[model samples]
Target: MTTQPERLQHLLDRLLRGVLLPEEAEQLAGAVRDLERRADVSDAVAKGNLRHVKQLIPAVRAAEARVHELEAEVSRLTAGQCTHSLAICETHHAKPVPGCPYPRCVAARATGRAATA
Candidate 1:
């Protein structure tokens, strides 16, 4: 579910970095739609329009936080830090908190292979 947005963002980020083409601008609509849905859902529960109030209320808050995080990640990648070390890359591994970048085992495996090679 969350994978689609992350994949699209990565592809779009690359395309923009390469040429900033209008073709790449084509994704704006879908992005806008996604954000709109997120916002609408959030507002519905927040303003007391939606049912299942107790369960939905928390879900809405979480969605809002996700929007903020995605916005920041877009900002960061747009600012030309996309090529930074994965160790420091935001959202690299999807750890609930920040700074997970990637798993330690992947690095360990790579190092193990390199040492044997």
Candidate 2:
């Protein structure tokens, strides 16, 4: 027997190939509803986790503050370094540099225009 996910994939493949029959359409709808239900449950669980984290934050306030300070120090130390490499052109307001291997940069260089923010 096919799992819900497998059935969903099959239904999607059939949908992409042609119109679904009435029963197939109903099946697809059911699959979509099931997926939505799962997503809702996941969202609720995430929200519960977030609430738990928030409750614990006060207990770890000192540690959290130290972490923030360390993060700031690291940022200051790396300020002069190019962390993103050619992905951002420092001279061009963080736009991709011309001749950059990234597709957007290649397209920009081809058009003789700097990428806009």
lDDT of each: 0.56, 0.68
- Candidate 1 wrong stretches, greater than 4 Å: 15-18, 49-117
- Candidate number with greatest TM-score: 2
Instruction: Evaluate model 1: give its lDDT.
Output: 0.56
Which residue pairs does candidate 2 place in steric collision? none
Which residue window of length 10 is worst by lDDT in model 2? 87-96
- The candidate that wins on lDDT is 2
lDDT per residue (tens digit) for residues 1-117 in model 2: 999789888889989989777799899998899889999999999999999999998879988999989966654433323345543433433443423455555566577665443
Residue-by-residue lDDT tens digits, candidate 1, 1-117: 648778678757777688645665567556777889999989977777545676688998999999999977864553243245544333343322222223442343445432112
Q: TM-scores for all candidates?
A: 0.30, 0.50
TM-score: model 1 vs. ground truth: 0.30
**What's the true lDDT of residue 26 in model 1?**
66
Query: Each model's RMSD to truth, in Å?
Result: 25.6, 16.3
Q: lDDT at 6 for candidate 1? A: 89
